[model samples]
Target: MPEAIQFVPYVLVVLLTGIPTWKLLVRVGLSPAWAILCLIPAGFIIVLWLIAYRRWPLLEE
Candidate 1:
């Protein structure tokens, strides 16, 4: 396996993605428990909530 690189930019991305993900769920009227999971891959989001939250803002066609 290739060694993982630990750089400032990569760490920043992790913090940026993880923090507001918690807040976004509240804004959307969803439970806090689901916010952290929002940080997961978009494919999982699509699969999990497809029938309800059908609009995928970031996903490519």
Candidate 2:
């Protein structure tokens, strides 16, 4: 049971980072679920590159 406590902070961190990331992706016309990528090792970089190079839907208008 004690070991489970160690993961609480990590879960909080993921939620803190993920919620805003999800919102940002949505605003940029990407799926909010893409924010789940940020939870993986080095996945934030992958998402960053994808967002940087991909054309935003808002800009198309």
Candidate 3:
């Protein structure tokens, strides 16, 4: 039971970061589910580059 309490903050952090990330990705025309990638160090940076370059698939003209 005590161990479970320790996981609460971790879960909250993921939700706090992930939810907004998902929305940001969706607004940029990328898949919203990619939000889970923000939880990873490399993926987080990759997402930043994706946005910085405006390289989402939907951006192709």
Top model by TM-score, which number? Answer: 2
CA lDDT scores, all candidates in order: 0.52, 0.84, 0.78
Model 2 regions lying over 4 Å from their true place:
none
Better of 2 and 3 by TM-score: 2
Model 1 regions more than 4 Å off: 1-10, 38-61
Per-residue accuracy of model 3 over 1-61 as CA lDDT, tens digit each: 9999998987887787788888888878877777777777577778777767776565575
**Worst lDDT window (10 residues) for model 3?**
52-61
TM-scores of the candidates are 0.41, 0.78, 0.70
Residue pairs with colliding backbones in model 2 are none
User: What's the residue-level lDDT of 24 in candidate 2?
Assistant: 81
| Tens-place lDDT digits, model 1, residues 1-61 | 2345546655566467656655655555555566455445573364346325744344434
Descending-lDDT candidate ranking:
2, 3, 1
Off by over 4 Å in 3: 55-61
Error of 3 at 44 (Å): 2.8
Top lDDT model:
2
